[model samples]
Structures are given as C-alpha cells and as structure tokens.
Target: MADKEQFFSNVYDVVAAYESGFVGAYGNPEAAEALRDQIKSAGGIPDGAMACSTYKLEETGKGKLSLPFLEILKLYPDCLPGGAQGRGDCVSWSSRNAALGTMCCEITSGIPDPNSGRLEGAPEVTTTARLNGVLSTEAIYNWRRHGGDGWSCAEAAQVLLNDSGLWLRKKYDEIDVDFTQYSARNAGLYGSRTPPESWRKIGENHRVQTVTEVEEFEALRDLLANGYCVSSCGSEGFSAERDANGVSKRKGGWAHALAYLAVDDRDEIKKLYSEPLVLIQNSWGAWNDGSRRIFGTNIDIPVGAFWARWSDIKNRYMVAISGVNGWPPKKLKSYGARGFI
Candidate 1:
C-alpha cells in the first residue's frame, strides 16, 4: 500500500509540474533533466520507487512466438510497420490496430486463397495484401474526416476497420488521394463524419468489437492470449516528444492511439515494479533513428515500441477495440456502450 501511494503521489507531482508552466521541459532534454533535479531536491520522489523498462524479447527471455497472438508477426512482420511521420498520428496508429486485428483473424480462421474465388464470404483475405492497402498515411487520413486535425482514436479505428475491405485492400499507388487537401476541404467538424448512427452499418461490413470498459490488465492479457491485438486511446503517456529542432526529449503525456501487442508475464515484471508492464507498438518511427535519440538512457524505450505500467493504463486508458471472428460474444456486449454504432 505504501508503494502504491508513493507511486501515485509521484505521478501527481510530475503531472502537476508539467501542467504548471513546465510544459516545455517535456520537449527539452536539458530542461527536463534540470526539472528532475529540482524535484529530487524537493524530495518529491520517494525512495525505493519502482522502475520499469520497455519490453524486449531478448532481455525478458520471452520470444514473440511464445505468445500465440504475436506468432502471426513472425509470418507477417511488416503487418504493423511504423512511420506515421506526424501525418496520421492517432488515426494511423488506430489503423495499425485495425490492420493487425484483420491479420489476427486471418491467422485464426485461415487466410482465403486469392485464387479460391471464395473472397465473397471469406473469413479473412490476404494479410500482406491488406496491409499493403492501408499502410499509406494519405489513404487513412482521407477516410472518415472528423475535424481539421484528426479523428478521435475510436472514430478512426472504427471507420478504418469497418471499411477496410474497400479502402485497406487497395495499394497506395493505386489511390490518388491528398490528405492535406482533404483536411482543408473538411475542416472544423470536431467529430467523426461517420457518426454514432452509422456504426451498425459499419459493423455489418467488418467484424470488430469495441469495449469502453475493459478489465484493464486481465482483459488485455486475455485478448493477447487469444491471438488478438487491442487498439486503445488515452490522454496520458507519451509516444514521442521532441523539441523545435526535432530532437527527441523527455517522455510526457499526449492524446494518442496505440496498438497493445503484448504484456510481460506478471511474475517477471513484478520483480521490477508493483505492476506488470505492457508492450505497445507506436506509429512513430524508430526512437533511435536520426535526430530522435535525445531520450537517451533515461528511458530505455525502443524505437516504435515501449512498456507502460498497468497502473497508468488503468487510470488513463479510455477504450479498446478487439477483433472478432464471428459475432462478438455476449460478455463483450456488456461493454457495448463503447461502440461507435
């Protein structure tokens, strides 16, 4: 209990500091270091605070194939490739989830042979072919334009997944759409163009279940254990932080969508912290590539993926989208209030 209380207090202090004119520090390494020193001097952080590191198969001795859901990645490693380039942000991130979900369905139900002529009612089509279709930032950005900026993570994920067959199957070069022009034409809506009323229609086209109230740790573990990825949205945690010159800095809060790939076993992670850690893949390209290495050893997070504590996720995560093979189960229906339809 003392450990939990101390962790919460530390989080509160850090969030308060960031909200109270220390915002720039979050994007500046030198400034963040100075702020950390000040916090230490003020005794804000308690002794014996738990520390967690990003999940790495090698470091944890847990191979990706050991987890059934992640095994698909071995056959289709590029299914969740990174490179949002600030264009897609949450939209692209959610699209990655939708894509991964589709791939999982293919793996579980078996991919339809392109020459089988059974594409009409097939459970899933070619995984790589589908990935090739939606991998473009411009393609996803054009679909379901909500506001001038970007759609909420849920809105984007729902639309992209539901309409994936029509949009996600086409190659990038085959489509000639300009996201900049699309955003300019459809500016200031503040919500998804598809709207909540259209969810039923959307679901008719795709097999996905959106849950607003997840059991946090257990739900995520179960979903991953079943060979599925969860698409999540939250206003906390940092995917990437950089300064004016594009130098990576300290990690901080951001409203974003990410694909929850896997979590380290509770037994192994409990060795370092009071809670287990989850592995998430980000749309942001490699963390160490180019000018993005400023995060340094302070956060041992890798490029495109990182480990987040379960406590933080429980507190800040808002929703999760799990792909289903047939009709969504009855247990998931209780969490239906989260669906867009």
Candidate 2:
C-alpha cells in the first residue's frame, strides 16, 4: 500500500508541475525551471539527477532538463513523464484510465507487401492494397458532413465493447474499457468531430476479412485459444503460435504482432512479444505510427493492451501452415511455465 501511494503521489506531483506551467516553454528554459520546481516538490534532487548514466554532457557542460526528467522517470517508471511524450492526441477510451498516452497509430494507411519489393516508401507499401484510403475516406467524410460520425480508436473500442457486451452496462471488469463512454461524452465536451455511428463493414470485397461480431466472453475466449499468428506483411509466411520453447504464442494482425505471455490472476493478459515488456512489432520502426517513442515517441504496453477470449483471438489471427523445414526440439516443461502458444 505504501508503495502504491508513493507512486500515485509522485505522479500527482509530476502532473501538477506540467499543468502548472513548468512545461510551458515547449522544451525551453522556462519549462526546465517549472520542471525543477516540480521535482523539488516531489522530493527529488535536481542537480544530482541525470537524464541517463550514458548520456554525455553537452559540450559546454550544460545541465539538461530532459536528463533529470528522464532520471525521475527511471526512478518512478509509472509516473507521468515531464512532458506530453506519453500523452495522446485524441480523447478516446485510453485517456480515462491514466495519463493520456502518446499516439502510436501507425499509418496502416499505405503499407505494401514486404515481398513486393516496391521501394516507393514504407507508408506507401502499407497503405497499398489495404483499406487505408477507404477507411480514412469514410471516416473523414462522415466526420466532416455526416453527423461527424466516423471511425476512430474510440469507435474501435466501442465495437469491442459492443461485441463483448460490455456496452450493455452491467458490472464492468475492464475499467479502461469504460472509456468508450467518453467517445461521445468527451466528444461533446471537447467539441470535436464525432465518430460515425457505424463503420464500413469489413468484408472480403473490401479486401478485409472480419468475423461476425460476437458478444459472449466465453466463446470469445475459445476463439483466441486457437488462433495462429499471421504476418502483417500479408506474405505467405506465418509466425509460429508457440515459440521454440513453446511457452509464448505469437499474436498478429493487420497492423502489428506480438507474442502472448501468460494471463494474470484476473485473466488479464501479459504480452512477451515486445521489449521492455513484450515488444509490439510495428511495420513502421520507431518513426512511424504504432511504434514506440523510447527516444522520442513509443508504445510501451505495461499491463498488456487488451484481453480477448480465444474465440476473438482466433478471429483476429487464424492461419494454416503447411510446409516447414526445421523445427525446434521438444520441451514440454517450458510449455507449462510459459503456456505454449
């Protein structure tokens, strides 16, 4: 309890300083001063704090504010950082839970097949032959002229809620899922364009395949249990469900892919796919959307993003692998420890 309380207090101090005007200069001297005050109030020493042990001091030996802030971050990993690096751009389901996170929406806009060998650009490749333009056009058009209703991350959350029956409003398990309510409520408060009532139906005709929207948690869980990860690159290559040791399983979708670790006591997920936790592999390295900003902007999943029953998992990631050359040796013990994918 003391640990949790201390963590919250530290977060409050950091947030208060940022909101007060310490971060006002947009990374200028004034912002640094506000940060210093914030750190002092939060019971941190300023001069002694360093950005990182490895960061070389500036040529003139000037003390950098970002460094101290980074040190504070290292000390209290969960506290909101000094600036908006972890903040989100749009008010969506994520904002209601904790600090508004930095946007990591990789432009699935125009990515192409990796094997296509088309070097026009990364974004161009992703958006190609994908629903990027269609989805964007529909969303933008609906938001602009038609009731300001279009697709957004919030809408996606709503769809998840609606299908999961969480929108029906009984007793909620996923507190973060409740932020779906903000999609419209905050939309009104912030006076931003509202998302569309419905989204373009994902279909084979649209070059997108979708399962029937389901609501049963148990059934959803079942689907996820059987899903095999597919590459986002849209190539014939598919990722292994169970790793070599057969503990973690790979979960992939159109935008990103990661390995699934064990579930928590509450049945919450713990991903092992990415780094720092589990790395969520984005086609766009660190620069593009959906990527982490470890240096500047990045996506770091602490508690794992969302939980889906095996049914939903299967619907999201189902593939059939036929030919394979080499396979890993049998390791049943590892399977039990990690839950083979």
Candidate 3:
C-alpha cells in the first residue's frame, strides 16, 4: 500500500498535469475531450485512487485530482506548519464585517500561537475574539437604526486594528449581533475614518501600517510568503456555482472584502500553462461538499474559501495591510508610494 505522502505526491502530479493541459483541458470543451482521450490511452487515474466530485471535474477538469488533494492533506493534520491555520475558525457574519477581526488577528498576532494551547503552533482564534476586535455588529446596527449607515472596507479594517486592545470575548448572547442592516462600501482609505473614540480605547498594542495601490500579484505573493495576509476589497459578483457533489466553484461577482491567505504556485503548471492560483481564507464556512468541518462544530462554513484565478484579482481593487510584527521590508521600502504610516 502506498504511504500517505506518496499518495499525495501522486495526486499533486495528476493535478499539475491537468493544469498543464495534459490530462484534460480546463475551460475548453474540444481540448478537454481530446485530453481525456489521451489520459485514457495512458490508463486513467489508477484504480483505488480517490475520486473528486463531478462538479470539480467539470469546473477545473481536474476534479478527480483536486478533491483528493484537499482530502489527503486532512489525513495529516500535523502537516500544517507554523501559523498556517490562521484564526482557527471561520466567521459567518455579513461579508462586510465577518473577516475584519480574523484578518486583523491573523496579520498581527499570528494564528495558532504555540502558547495558546492549540495544535502546537495552530492556536484557534475564537469567533468571540473576532467580534471583540472589530466594531461590533451591535454598534453597526444601532448606528444604522439612528440613520448613521454603512461602512467601507477600509473603515472595517482600520477600526478593528486600531481598537485591538479593547477587544474582549463576550458571552454568545452579548455578542450575537446582526449585520444585515448595514450597507457595504467597496473602497476606503485606511485610517481615513477613525474608529469611534470609545471603541479605540483598548487596542493600544495593535497598530496598522497600510499599503495601498498594490497593482501586482507578485507583491501579493511576496506578502503571503513573508507571513502577512492581505485584506482586499473586490467584486463579490464572482459566481460561486456548486457541482452535483456540492463543491463550490467560483464564477464572477461584484465588490467585497476577502483575506488573501496563500498561493498554490504549481510552478510546473505555471511554467507550462500559466495558471497560478491564490488561496483565500473566507469568513464563510466549509463550502466544499460538506465533507470536513473547519471551525470546531459550525458546519455552515462560508462558500468563499476556495482557490481563485490571478486574473480575478487583477480586474479588481486591492489593498494590503501589515500589522506590527507582520510588516515586510518590501512594503516598508515602498511606503513612499501610496503607503500610509
């Protein structure tokens, strides 16, 4: 029997081949059919191989390859390295507010702190922690009821970091706030709208250094490489279609905020087919076929946690945030151009 690592390697190779247009062409019918024939001639995925859902197969044409990739990784829970499992939980609040606290915590304190009693370095950031770090949904609700209104991505990001010290994990009932009443804004300059003075009192230790106008994916990649997760504002209209297996696939969409986590370089595929993808940690729960539950027990994981095309990012507005102990030197050197201290 093949060991798990070897099994995963085989899966990776299959995916790389598919992405390289060898097994099946992605996004092309005739090419996909031709490639499928080639794969059959070469003997299809080996018997006893893990199978991906039909939806993933149709969407990426490598569903057979992709599904197993995620599943195999789950088998080795210890495989995730330092700070890899950011925040340890998914937030299901409004897209506008759900990610702020988690993103802030991820970029500032490092997820899964070894001292926090999690999976060694994988400390879980509670949903309560996220709520406390940001402007509470209760505040947003009250503001709107009094006719104050919505917040911009920048506002959400800034307020959370600026008030990190004041963040407190309250009982579920006390913090169970609603975001449906708030409106959403696509853009805002970091720190342009200061958080209310009252909310700003507690987070003296948390500070933000904002980097804006980052037009290149390489910069985003570099930031992730350096342990900094970026908060981006982009169109949410990206269609999220699910296959018969209920695995979610991204289409196109309008504006929203997302925390950029890691990138699956697939260097071999990029060298041959130019299809590098980004991994985003979404506030939504596990949207993939309902197989694994990400956060402790919540199953309604958002559908936003999925791999996305680089082009999808290029067509949208983006900004990167670096908190204290999280700032990369490249970002620091380029601060003169569109950066805010």
Q: Against the unseen true structure, what C-alpha lDDT does each candidate score?
A: 0.40, 0.21, 0.33
TM per prediction? 0.51, 0.20, 0.43
- What stretches of model 2 exceed 4 Å from their correct place? 1-145, 149-206, 228-341
Flag the better candidate by TM-score, 2 or 3.
Answer: 3
**Which candidate has the top score in TM-score?**
1
RMSD of each: 16.7, 24.4, 20.4
Pull out the clashing pairs in model 1.
287-303
lDDT for residue 179 in candidate 3, whole number 0-100: 23
- What would the per-residue lDDT of candidate 3 be over residues 226-288, giving only the tens digit for each residue? 333455555443334433322234554423345555444455435533665655544323323
Task: Tell me model 2's lDDT, rounded to 2 decimals.
Answer: 0.21
Mind sharing the TM-score for model 1? 0.51
